[model samples]
Target: MNKYLMTIKNKQYIRFFLIPTILCLILAISVVFVLLNQRKGELVDLENRSQLQTSLLSEKIAGKLNSLELVLSMINQSARSMDLDNETDRERLISLVKSQLYLQDDLEGLCILSPDGSKIYSSFHIITENLLENQQRMITTHTRQDISFSLFSFIDNKAWHLVLSRSLFDQSGDLVAIVGLLIETHSFFDLLSVTEIPGLERAILFDTAGKTIATWNQKDALGKETIHLEENIHLIPSFSDSNILNTQDQTINAGIKTVRFENSLLTTVKLGNFPLSLGMETFIDKAMASYDNALVISMSVLFLFIIISLTVITLLGKQVIEQEQVQQVMMDELSEKVKSRTAELEKLSTLDSLTGLINRRKINSLLAEQIDNRSKEPTFCCIMIIDIDHFKLVNDNFGHQTGDEVLIHIVRVLQQSLGPLGTLSRWGGDELLVLLPSHSAQQALDIAKDLLVHIRDNPFSPDIMSTISIGIAQYREGELSSDLISRADTALYEAKGSGRNRVILG
Candidate 1:
């Protein structure tokens, strides 16, 4: 039963990749669907708002026109009753205009102008008798636009007002005077104050020149293009008919725009007849914030799922391979038997019989891995070639066995000295190599000096104490492993030529 269970475990069929991946894919697709749906819904909302803005802009502007209509009514009424050439008729026209404005509060003052821009009447009794006679010196001279309603600045600069003008005529069709009323623009912008999708959206009114007449935010823009392509509400098309009802969303540019028009101007409004158009936009930050949050959550779940799946696969693979248990069992059985058999091989592959340090073959492989994996951290390292000082004399004087003993003891010392900072290897018979990982030339010099001091100070064996010569060179980019090793080796030759037992800086 146990064997059968192990066989079943080795089958490696327990994983759920087909399902989990499909499910992950499905979940990812669902997230994309959710994102797309949310975006679509928001866009639909934006489209609806744009439509309503177009309509409401007409209505809001129509409401704005309501004040102008009242002023036009004043102009039309004044011309109906009076024969303006007579003094009685002229005074009657002035009194009639003032009386009509008596109930209207937005009217700062009303005025009648001749074609030559002379004020025929003033609503304020404070008007001087000759104020009309002095054309240039009177109040402020405003350029006249015929038959249109506009918001204009008042003289005291205390407030803004909507001005309406129309061609006034007698019943017999004789031309008389121009009547205009100043309606406070503040009230017109106030009606448009509204909020949608929390504080993410805003509404605005643009004039015939694409200049914003009013906005929910206080924009000091009377002439600046609100419908400029890279500007304010962002490139509303020129009005084709009296109304513009559709638009496209554009990608963002780097520069951020400020909201210029203000008042309490925002509200969802119904459709009506008006010349001005309305536009509402969602703040990119607010709209994309929800999408970003969803993506982050989805990515987190995806990464967690991937990690768990990989871990499960690895564990399952280990169970199937059974390599560790097999190897451990083999090693345990051979532990005693192989010990005495390899006696002549005290060489133990590449171990210096004198020292237990690694051979050059292992160092070569280690260097290959280090250099290849160094993409993660591309930096310099130092290579040092170490050789014993006057080794022929040491061996000849002390006999080969004692000499061998000295080499072994020195290898042991080098291995212990490097610790984990470097890879210590027996380069050839008496030569050694030390690769100090991520170490600079100066650091390598210090290390070489330290090692030399330790060797000269420590007793080599019962009979002798000795020191080593080291030549250190820093590794550079594009240098082959062999070339780097050769450089250090050359430095070592230089050290030997210089004297014995000194570190030659390369």
Candidate 2:
């Protein structure tokens, strides 16, 4: 057959192609095996490090809580030592509560409730009638003989607050009054804030019931009363001396010992004497991000070389009839195409495709340039950190597509408002930064106010009207860009705290 004759004629070319293909396959397998082994070792080390970090976090929380407990005990002993029956002693006790209890940063307020459930005194305003009723109910429900902390309860349906109560008794052991210190739930978050670990993907605290209480990444999850545990509760670790649980298993099973979940390792430690568990999850993907990128680049080069080898072999096979100059031209065209593709990828790195604005990397470079030349300039330069208020709500309710549209709309409005005087860039999720050179702080504030008014008047969508909070920081002559941004960020939070849709100067 003519096919058999053609195969015989090209046998040498076929042998050359198959040899390199087999070699390439073997090399790929070896690379994969090595990468897997390296990843396994890294994961093991990460687990050990995470476990140690979790242990340290537990010790810290315990020490802080115990210190607070000691302070509470001392206050209770001092209160019990005073004779409340005497008017002079009562006046002294009031002074003690005002000077000592009210002054503590951990305490939001202090209240003294009479045995009959009437409010004797409060550090804040006089207790409202509703708050008095709730306090009375709480006192009756928690009639512990010793110091105790109540479950988080809302104050007049506003904010979640916990009450640390100590019941006082006279010489005859008759209950006189219950002293309660109001602790805002924010205090617990402040305590947990120190537990944040570097390279941690997520750090969350859950109650014994597996209900999420606080999270470092998901701040909105706090005070969500309806939140409950799911079947993934199997991930919750049983308190043991090991003080760590991690597994890299395909399924969640009881016998499994590793703390691996998906591409992340779960590390947990129980808080001492509290029905809370701290969970720290670190992702292997992120840990290996750099290595993976390099591997990809190497693989791409290897594939390119393989393609060139095949092209050269094919060209040589046709050398009996074709010219060598034609093969050289083809190679040059391929090289040019590869270079163009690389250039395109490099260009994309500096842009945000969604908003079509300069990305964080570009903005950072610009900021650095501005900071470097700030001393030479006479007029002030300012960084405005602008955040769209409740932007996450828009994504949650209207979906991400709508969210993208909203972002684009915002970028358009900002561009029109800022004009050529300022450079606008995407700072983060729902955050944008505007750098204004040769503008005074007062001038920047005026622009910020006008931008806010413009946003309030021009709605993003029919259902979702968006407002922004702006925090402006004027660049100090000798300060670093980071410090300037930090001040701006702090002021941004202040703006959000005071009320959204406002501008604050840092």
The candidate that achieves the highest TM-score relative to the unseen native structure: 2
Q: How much lDDT does candidate 1 score?
A: 0.60
Per residue, candidate 1 scores C-alpha lDDT tens digits across 337-367 of 5876675365476565456677887788778
The best candidate by lDDT is 2
The positional error of residue 415 in candidate 2, measured at the CA in angstroms, is: 99
TM-score of each: 0.44, 0.48
**Tens digits of per-residue lDDT for model 2, 231-257:** 455555553222111111111212212
lDDT of each: 0.60, 0.70
Off by over 4 Å in 1: 1-23, 123-162, 195-202, 218-275, 287-295, 298-506
| Clashing residue pairs in candidate 2 (N, C-alpha, C atoms within 3 angstroms) | 246-258, 246-259, 247-258, 247-259, 247-260
> lDDT score of model 2?
0.70
Candidate 2 residue runs with Cα over 4 Å from true position: 1-14, 44-49, 126-137, 144-160, 169-175, 187-202, 219-231, 239-260, 263-266, 281-292, 305-506
What's the lDDT for residue 463 in model 1?
61
